[model samples]
Target: MSVEAWTTVLVILSFIVYIYIGWRSRVSDTKGFFVAEQGVPAVANGAATAADWMSAASFISMAGLISFLGYDGSIYLIGWTGGYVLLALLLAPYLRKFGKYTVPDFVGDRYYSNVARSVAVVAAIFVSMTYVAGQMRGVGIVFSRFLQVDVSTGVVIGMVIVAFFAILGGMKGITWTQVAQYCVLIVAYLIPAFAISMLLTGIFVPQLGFTFGDIVEKLNAVQVDLGFAEYSQPFANKSMLDVLFITIALMVGTAGLPHVIVRFYTVPNVRAARYSAGWALLFIAILYTTAPAIASFARYNLIDSLHNKTVAEVQQLDWATKWENTGLLQFEDKNGDGRFQLTPEEASNEIIVDRDIIVLANPEVAQLAPWVVALVAAGGLAAALSTASGLLLVISSSIAHDVYYRMVNPHASEAKRLMVGRVMVGFAIAIAGYFGINPPGFVAQVVAFAFGLAAASFFPVIILGIFDKRTNKEGAIAGMITGLAFTIFYIVGVKFAGMPTWFFNVSAEGIGTVGMILNFVVTLVVSRLTPPPPADIQALVEELRDPTHHVPIALTDIGEEQLD
Candidate 1:
């Protein structure tokens, strides 16, 4: 069969496997839908968490970004992984111990205010949507290339597939399906890297290939010869503070992400949550550490193929012609020298290398087999779909459980709530599809914005709620609002409105770090000025702190339905 045919077959089989798993694991109750009945084992939950964390950004676009950005891309590595540590040590165990269905459940009950809950729900929905939109776009990109369809059609297909698994099985279906996805994606990602590694350095391991052979030195030599900076040097031309702040922002944002943090709630107990985090990091590190090797390999191959070659010669290369059709790679001889120059000024053709194409095109670029290329298509979809389903669940559950059931229809039955959650999943997918069809920016940039928003809005209040008993409703609400407003304004002004610069020259991606400080300061001052939380709520916080204490009923059960 042809490459496209093989790709289609592999992709179809993957969807079938996921749909089957989801069908078998279907849930009927609100608890099952939202938290998978809290029965997931630590190891499985860890795998699911890894799937949830390694989204399209990590799988498809990250290597591309690293390929181009070189040292600057290290921020994504450090920031995202570091955030998992923060989550394990500071947030996950406590939140899991608190045992609410959603993040808003904690915020509302802790503050003893519906208004506080509403704020958290809004924040959750907003952050999840932002994150999911990027995932949907990722789905579209992968499907479009493999299925030979328009991006919009690919997005619609993605929506239907996600709705099938997400609405059908809820958390139970998604979690197990994610385990399968993790296996598919990790294997798919590693194979191409390993293939390229052996070709270049005769090394079996891509991670070891980086330092084991002459590949790194050759890659850097080629890059410098091409008039670009050395690929191995850290802090090449970028500002140190900018890199530092972006890393910090991403770390906090990773911890603050509702969808990722929600995974811990699916595990059985606080111990599972902690252990799951460790396993998650181990799984993620496999890809996280290997990505740089792939990036360097891809960069080396790309430059080697094009440099000192004529336009006609380049056009003859199958990979070059294939990518040029997508408009992601182009060639023009401006000086009519007939040869492609690596330097920017002399190079006639504008090589608008869309950062996303790096990973998806890596197999073709490295001249790998058709099967490896097909596997990449499947892997990309798995990465995007798994993350999308998880985020959609978070958005839907927050709306149904936190907003509608908790506030509007407190008398709603468990069955009714479960149905509402499923419907909301479909609704959320539609909205995410709209954004996918019409992305505001690149997938990574848009996702980074979501991270910043999450960092600014939820991180401060959540940490304080756990660690500071004196923080009252007024303080939490004020902090969330202040943090969200500043972060949003800075992002909008800089990204959309053409604001020249922000405080400390921090980019929009890192501005959340500044917003976090504002949130902390406002929350501290306001908490001191306001009355402390009621005695009962304060005692509840105290109990949550004591790891030995038996978890209260509120933490373990679906909250009692309140009357209107």
Candidate 2:
């Protein structure tokens, strides 16, 4: 079969499987829609969490980022993976034990104030919107390239598919579907990586392939010959300070992401939550380890393929022309030479080629079979769609459940609330699709800002709410406002005013790092200055710590009064 044929088959199969799962697990009540009725097994929850966590950023763009940035990319690898440790040790178990449907619910009840809950709702919406826009863009990119459709058409297709599954399955459908998606996406990601790694380093394992001394020697020679920094080493241009700060920011931000933390709530108990984190990390490692190999292999092949090829020759290549048509790859015959030169002189001034193309274009560059390429295309779509649906659900729930039901109408009917949530989903998708079509900047950069916001505003408050008995509503609210204000101000300042040229002299990468520190400090200071939480709030904390006291209740069995 042709690559396109194989791609069609895979995508069709994936869609059918997802729809079947959704149909099988369709929810009739709010509990099933929101928390899967807290029945998800640890293993299944782990897989779902992995799929939810590995957004378009991980599946489509991380390798590309690494291909260009070299050692600096390790920050993402370590930072993201290491976050599971924090989740496992500090956050997940307690949150699970708390037995809440949303992060805001925990905040609202623990702080004894609807205002604290409202603050969480705002942060969740902002983070989810920022993240979802990137996922939609990923869907558009995959569709445009592999499906031979325009990006706008692809976005529409994606929206329809997600709406169908999410509206039907809710959390129950999404969890099982995401487990399947994790399998598809991880397989799609690792197959090409393994092929490339074996071709270049004669190793099947990408982690070992990267460290193979013989391959490193060859890459070092290639780098020196091309007048580029040695491939085996870090970039000379990147400052040590920048690397440190970026790593810290990513670590904190990973811990802060509400969508990821919310997964813990689906598992049955504290022990399951801990085990689920382990499972999530194992799944994530499958991609993270292979990603750097894809980066190394693709970078090597890209430079080798284009090094001395004529413009005419490159234009004749199928992949080159295809990508050029998408405006993702561009070339210029600088120095008036007919042959393309990929040295620093050419890389510095040519039209900007998007980093996201590295994974999409890798198989073609290696001259691999078309089926491999098609599988990658399917994987990219799966990654984007799965994440988009999850984010949309969170956004809709925040508005409908947190804002409408909790604040606006405490006596709202279940049917009315469900209708409101679905409407909110539709509205959020439309707005997010617009942003994806005309992205303001790099997808990853925008995602980082979202992470920064989460790290600054939500993570600290949630942590304090669970662990500290003395953290009152006043402290939590003040801390959230102060942290959010400072972080946003700093982000805008640096983005517009150019860093002060002296503040901490940390690398610009440390923007999130600084924001996260400010959040933690403000929370601690405010909590210390305020009165202790009410006696009932302290009791809630005690209840959260004792997993044995709470029994799992099926959604169909739980009453509306229990939820309230």
Candidate 3:
């Protein structure tokens, strides 16, 4: 089959499989919709968790970012993956033991305040929306290429498919479908990487080939010849502070994300939660390790194809000509010279390459089979669709369970709540589709904001709620307010006002590191000043500290007893 035909077949096959899983696993009750009735096995949940966590950012953007950034990209690999360690050890099992449906449930009951739960809900909504927008945008990008349609049309198509699964099946449906997505995406990602690896170095392993091949050395020599720095050099273009704090923000932020944390809630028990985290990390590490290898291979091939070639000659190259039509790769005869030379000087090269296109374009750059290119298109969509479905569930559950049932109508029936949750899923997906049509920025940039916000608003408060028994409602509320408000202010200031100077030279992406520290300080100071939480709430904390015991009933009842 032709490339277009193969792309159509692969994408349709993956979608049919996912839709079938969603239909088979559809949930009727609130418990099943919200947390899969806590019946998922550890290994299955782990695979689902890996799919949920590896959004378009990991699947499509990480390799592209690394292709351009060189060793500085290690911050993303380390920061993104390291946070799973924190989640597995510090938070996942304990939260699972708490036996609540949502993160807000823990916050509200732990602090013995509805106001705190409401705050967490708002934060969850914000974090999930920000994250989902990027996922939808990624979906649109892949679909635009796969279906040969416009991005806006692709986004609409993607939104409809997501709504079908997320609105009907909820978490149970999403979980099983995501397990299938993990298989599709991971296999799709690995094949092209292994093919490119073998082609470049006569080795099947991309990671080993990346380090062992003479290709990198040759690329480095080309960089020197072109007056640009070596591609393998550390911190080639970024500041040390940018790398340091961004890594920290992303690491802690991963632990704070609502969708990812909620994955732990699907496991059968506290022990399963812990085991699931380990398995999830192991699965994620497979792609995380291979991404750099693909990045290196693509980077080398891209530079090799362009260096010493004239603009006219470059226009004739199949990969360059193909991507140029998409506006992701552009060339101009600046300085009136036809030759292309990628030097440090802006005018040295005639090409302007969009970093986002690296992975999608990698197969073509390597002159791989057309079918491999089609598979890559399908893989990118799987990554985006899986994560988008998970985030949509988080957004809907926060509104239906946390806001409606928990806060507004405590007497609401499970059926009514499930309907409301489904409605909210449809509503949220529409909003995300809107953003995808008119994206605020690239997929990775929007995701960075999501991480920064989650790190600032949730990470410190959740840690304190678990570890600090004396941490009261007032302190937790004050901390979230400070963190959320200040982080948004910093992001707005840097992005809109062009505020050039930041505290300690931290970039906008790394400002969450600072926001987290301030949250901890404000929380501590406020907790010391306020009266301690009631005896019952304090006792509940003690109960949560031991993960060996599972609390099947609602924690809200425990909080209400103190009030009564």
Candidate 4:
């Protein structure tokens, strides 16, 4: 079959599978829509969480970013996956024990203040929207390439598919569908990676083999021949401080992401939460390990093919013109030469190659059949759509459960609240789709902003709420405000105003790290200065530490007390 034929079949089959899962698991009440009625098994929840966490950024762009950035890309792999370690040890179990539907609920009750809950709602919405926009853009790119549609059409189609499943089954539908997506996306990601890995290094494990031996040798040889620094080493011109800052920023940002933190809410118990984190990491590792290999192989192929080749020659090839039309792959003849230079300087030119295309382009580079390329296209869509669905759920739940039910209509009927939720999902999808069509910046760069925001705002409050008994509402609010303010100021200043000469002067690469530090520091200081939390707040903390304190009930059976 032709590549387009395979892509159409895969997309159709995947959508059918999702609609079937949604139909099978459709729920009639708010509980089923929000928390899967807390019935998700650890294994199932783990897979769902992996799908939710590994958005288009992980599936499509990470390898491309790594391909260009080389060893520095390790920051993303280690930072993102290592976050599960922190989640498993520090956050997930306690949040599960607290037994809440959303992060704001825990903050509201833990601090005994509506104001605290309202702050969390704002933070969640900001983080989720920013993250969702990236997924939408990823969807558009995949559609434009394999489906041969415009990006705007692809985004709208993606939005419709996400809304269909998210509205129909809510959390219940999303959970099972994501599990299926996890399977499709992982297979899609790893198959080509495995093929390329075997061809390049003769090693089965991409992660270990890419770093340890044969691949490094090849990279060094390529660098020497191209008159570039050895790819096996870090960039020689970059400062040590810049490297340190970027690494720390990425790590803290990973630990701070709200969508990732919220995944724990679906599990039934503390132990289950711990086990689920393990499962999520294992699933994520399948792709994470494969990503570097894809990067190495693609870089090798791109250089080998384009080395010393004229732009006219490359443009004459079908792949070059096709990619150029999509605005993904581009060639510029510098030095008034007709030839396309594959040098670092050429690759670094301001006219960017879309990072998301790296994975999709890998199979073609390897001379794989068109069917494999088509499978990769489907896989990219699956990754984007799955993550978009999860974020939409978060957006809807925040509006319905947090703002509408809690603030707007305290006594609203469950049915009325659910209706509002569904309406809000449509609105959110429309807004995100708009952004996807007219994306303001790079998809990966926008995602990094979201991560930085989450790290700054939510991470501190959740940590203090879970670990410290004395943290009062005053402290939580103050810390959150301080963290968010500093992060935004620093990011905006660096991005727009240019880095100030007198600032701590660490590379802006890790500004998120600095913001997280400020958040932690401010929280600790404010908590120490403020009076201890009320006695009931302390009691709530005790209750959250014990999973056996309450019985597990079907989501529909949950009362206000359980949800509150």
Write down the TM-score for model 2.
0.93
What would the per-residue lDDT of candidate 1 be over residues 329-419, giving only the tens digit for each residue? 7676667787876664434543556778789888987888888998998999999999999999999999999999988997999999999
After superposition on all CA atoms, what RMSD does each candidate show versus the true structure? Answer: 2.3, 3.3, 1.8, 3.3
Alpha-carbon deviation at 57 in model 3, angstroms: 0.5
Worst 10 residues of 4 by lDDT: 551-560
Winner on lDDT between 2 and 4 is 2
**50-143 per-residue lDDT for model 4 (tens digits):** 9988889888888888887787777778777777677777787777667678877777767666777788888778778878899999999988
Best of the candidates, TM-score: 3
Give the candidate order by descending TM-score: 3, 1, 2, 4
lDDT of 2 by residue, 1-564 (tens): 877788888899999999999899998777778888878999999899999989888888888887777777777787777766776678877777767777777777777777888988888887788788888888888888877888787788888888888888888889999999999999899888888888888888877898772665676688788777876577454677777777666677778787888788777777788888889888888888788878888888888877778877887888888887777787777667677666655544343468888898899899889999999998888888888888888888888888898779979998888888878888888988887787645556666677777777777887887778778777777777776776666666776677563556654345766766676677678878887765656776776666566653222222333232
lDDT of 3 at 251: 92
Q: How much is 41 displaced in model 3, in angstroms? A: 1.1
TM-score of each: 0.96, 0.93, 0.96, 0.92
Clashing pairs in 2: none
Give the per-residue lDDT digits (tens) of candidate 3, residues 273-363: 9899989999999999999999889888888788668867887876577667666677776777668666667756567887777888898
lDDT for each candidate structure: 0.87, 0.78, 0.86, 0.78
Ranking by lDDT: 1, 3, 2, 4
Model 4: lDDT to the true structure? 0.78
